[model samples]
Target: MLEPQDHRLRQREYLLQISRAITAQLDLASLLNLVITYAVEMLAGTSGLIAIYDEEGDDLLRIRASSQLPRDIWPAFAPLLALPLADLPRQGVAVLRDVATDTGLNLRQMIALPLALRQSAVGVIYVFRAALNVDFSANDRQLLQDFANQAAIAVSNARLYQGVLREKQRLDAMIEQSADGALIIDSRWRITTFNKMMEQLTGWTRDEAIGRPCAEVLGIHSDQGVNICLTDCPLQRRPPAENPVAEGRITSRDGREIYI
Candidate 1:
């Protein structure tokens, strides 16, 4: 058995380690698993679970992560999961809740904490003890609350990052497979994305075109023989809602003037 002081120090170390691991992990599944696993181990509980509210506003709480709870025992936990959101503790504190004993499960005590960010309850974390008299102390509740706060922040960030990544991938696919030549420029007027069709049109590969000035690559000239990119660049004056099409002559890499 660990000395009381030694156990406290070890709990602190586990919190530090969990904080580091959760923040660095962007994958939601892996982060949730890491959270429940460490939470169960740190609290010395027989089992634990993290239940997250559906983002689609279905008013449903689904088990996103669990540790050591047998597959058969999951149904016994259903009543707890189905508890109304209003019934769960949400004041940034963990509290003891009575677990049903008639379900043939040996669970006796549970410490429940809301995984909240700002004023919204995103989820709940529950740790269970099987011992008859092993009621969770105030210190255990506080420790779990602290850990749940960190886990909430990590979960929220991971969801946001995943949304951004998926959108980026979709936009990239559209740009790469576009029939018309397309390129994206940054605020500094430098090429940031040179799509495949642009390569066929300009005779310059993506690696060679990226970071170069858009005016230098396209070399577009107006009907009046003026270099429009240097004089009347539409990108500078166009309204955000407007998608105007202007025909211009471009000097290709092979010294051929191509009308586009």
Candidate 2:
């Protein structure tokens, strides 16, 4: 048996390793799998489950991962997810003793720790041990709580990142299909987004325009060939607007003068 200090040391190392693994994965499904697998491995639990709460008005808890549970008994555990989060302990865990005796499942004991952030619980992590007589010490609770905290942050970040990616995809689709010319620039005035319409208008393909300065690519000039884009750059003169409008004559890729 490891000494108390040694156990803590080992647990800390495990936490660091698992934290890296969790944060390294951005996909929600893959992150959940990593959570369950690391939970079972690090805690020496026989099986594990992670339930993520849906925040978009569903008030629903979805099971993100379940490992080594028999098909027939998984149904029994599913109902626990429907329980009022109000009933569960907020800062600690609720332990189930000898659940195998009650349900004839393979699990001997189980610990349910809420994945909490601030005062609210974002999700729950449950781990099962097959041992018949198990005693979870205060240190054990502390260790599980640590993992739960890190898991909550990783899950929440992944969900947020995924939502942003989906929204970006949706907007990109719209921008690509837009009728008028559309282009986007970074804070440094370098072209970051170039749509097909803008590509045609400027006669510069997206590959050629991205990362190039807007001044160089747009090459906007007055009718008398005086540089217009440099003097009236909207980003510098005006606050960012949703529907920004700029007008000038630009030299096309073919050296033709086009007025916008």
Question: Which candidate has the highest TM-score of all?
Answer: 2
TM-score of each: 0.70, 0.78
Please report, as a residue range, the 10-residue window in candidate 1 with the lowest summed lDDT: 91-100
How many Å off is the CA of 29 in candidate 2? 3.3
Q: Each candidate: what lDDT?
A: 0.78, 0.74
Residue 158 CA error for candidate 1 (Å)?
Answer: 1.4
lDDT, candidate 2, equals: 0.74
Candidate 2's residue-wise lDDT over 80-166, tens digit each? 676664654541233233235446656656667889887788888888787767755565666778878877888778777788989
lDDT of 2 at 69: 60
Residue 209 lDDT in candidate 2: 95
Question: What residue pairs are clashing in model 1?
Answer: none
- Residue range 154-239, candidate 1, lDDT tens digits: 77887788889899788878999999999989999999888998888888899999999999999789877888888878777656
